[model samples]
Target: AQSVTQPDIHITVSEGASLELRCNYSYGATPYLFWYVQSPGQGLQLLLKYFSGDTLVQGIKGFEAEFKRSQSSFNLRKPSVHWSDAAEYFCAVGAFNQAGTALIFGKGTTLSVSS
Candidate 1:
């Protein structure tokens, strides 16, 4: 079975400050990892993904993540956060099945940004 855990339920950041969110996963084999952002009442948008190769992957909105095989971790990082960056972030892992592939998500981490 595959599962993901996001330790932080919520985080608050000041504008122009850096931010980081933690994530850990349990999987039998290498998993497809992804980070998604969702605004209030909005659908999720892909921030980044780690399908294969390159431990470090970059995505839109100036977000980046490093896939650490040893730690089984893929943490999101931003050098500086903006007020508009306030949103809910979810860490997900993709699993393959007979039907197809599906994403299993974490509880999510809400980010509050203040100016």
Candidate 2:
């Protein structure tokens, strides 16, 4: 089955520290991967996505991810984190079927930034 996995359920980082959120996926073929961020009481916002071509993809808010087919990973990274970056991060895989495309989301990782 095609699914997304976020190993860390929660993570705490000091302000201005580098951050990396791990994400892994299992799919039959090259699948669409996406990272989304959801702030408290806010809807999900797209961070980045990987379709094809370049392995390294840049995203909004100074974020980026590298797609590694061998490792089946698409990890999100930021050189420096801000207090406002603390939010619930979700890794999702897009699955296509006769019913159309649907996103399978991981449990999510909660990021806490400390001063």
Candidate 3:
């Protein structure tokens, strides 16, 4: 079974400050890792993904993540966070199966940005 764990249930960051989110996964094999963000009442957007090749993947909005196979972790980081960045962030891992593809997601970590 594959599972993703995000230990933080909530995080607060001041505007223009840095941010980092932790993620850990368990899978039989190396899985595709991804980070997605969702606003208060909107759909989820892909923050970044690591399929193969470079362990460090760059994403939009100055976000990046490095996949650590040894630790089975992929942590998301941002040099500076904007108020608009306030949202629920989810760490997920995907795998291809006979049925097709499935993504296992963490509960989520809600980000609160303050002035």
**lDDT at 110, model 1:** 99
Give every collision pair in model 3. none
Segments in model 3 whose C-alpha atoms lie over 4 Å from true places: none
lDDT of 2 by residue, 1-115 (tens): 9989999999999999999999999999998999999999999999999989999999999999999999999999999999999999999999665467789999999999999
Query: Number of clashing pairs, model 3?
Result: 0
Q: What are the models' TM-scores?
A: 0.96, 0.96, 0.95
Query: Candidate 1's C-alpha lDDT?
Result: 0.96
Measured with C-alpha atoms, the lDDT of residue 14 in candidate 2 is: 97
lDDT of 1 by residue, 1-115 (tens): 8999999999999999999999999998889999999999999999999988999999999999999999999999999999999999999999765458789999999999988
Off by over 4 Å in 1: 97-99
- TM-score of the candidate numbered 1? 0.96
Compute the lDDT for candidate 2. 0.96
Sliding window of 10 residues with minimal summed lDDT for model 1: 94-103
Which of the two, 2 or 3, has more lDDT? 2
Q: What is the C-alpha lDDT of each candidate?
A: 0.96, 0.96, 0.94
